[model samples]
Target: MIKKVILLGMAVFMTGSIAMAQHGGPRGNKRGMAKDLTPAQLATLQTKKMTLALDLTAEQQSEVLRINTEDIEARQAEHEELKQMRLENDQSTNRAEAQFARQKARLDSKIARQEKLKEVLNAQQYAQWKKMNRHLERNRRQPPQ
Candidate 1:
């Protein structure tokens, strides 16, 4: 009877493990932002969020919306390019291709956004925006608890 109970418990444990493995992890289940939402909708959502965060004026909000639209389009293009790269099997398992110059384009894009934001926002708003960006970057880099 004890042996039967032990075997039953082992079978239940094995079944549970198989079920969880088949379900996959959060990262595997997640959809890309570009895939999940339209660019125009994304831009509008971002613009409204920025407006609330920065207390933007009507003119500032309109400018920010334009910027957000451009940003969303560019990001979508980048996403497509990345997908193409993956489809082409372009990424080599080499330190040369892995290190250096990889993030240069992304950083340049960020710098452009910073410059544009500086031109669009007042000093206080620009500072707040930078702080918010830093906070978001920090959160993105952190592992989930």
Candidate 2:
């Protein structure tokens, strides 16, 4: 009976570990490993995807690449800033104010990006880009099926 119990416990532990390894474990595949990518790599990949989806011309592609690079670099900087802010834990700062500021900044950035895209893309392409953004936002909010 002792031997059987030991074997059963070992089997359960092994199964749990295997499941963890397959499902991204603690470190997580949550970012799809995108957190590991450099800003330039992210920009290039995003621009290429947009080009493919929008059938962008050479000029438009270049413009979009620049926009993507700027956005990626800005986001990286903001991420680092937020990391530092979290580390500081300033008791003087209001958490609600910080949250509101962060959200407002993000919205402002999006609005600026949309304006830039509008200047670069035709009406049809702009519409398509908006549609693509909606789809991406939807997917980001939902867990994998």
Query: Which one wins on TM-score?
Result: 2
Q: Cα lDDT for residue 94, model 1?
A: 67
Q: What lDDT does each candidate get?
A: 0.82, 0.92
- Summing lDDT over every window of 10 consecutive residues in candidate 1, give the lowest-scoring window: 25-34
The C-alpha stretches of model 2 lying farther than 4 A from their native spots are 1-22, 25-32
Q: Candidates' TM-scores? A: 0.72, 0.81
Model 1 residue 75 CA deviation in Å: 1.5
Cα lDDT tens digits for candidate 1, 1-145: 9999999999999998887676564344434544688888888888899999999999998888888888879877877877777788875666466444546777887888788888999999999999999999999899855
Over the full model, what C-alpha lDDT does candidate 2 score relative to the true structure? 0.92
Model 1's C-alpha root-mean-square deviation from the true structure amounts to: 4.7
Q: Superposing all C-alpha atoms, what RMSD in Å does each candidate have to the true structure?
A: 4.7, 3.9
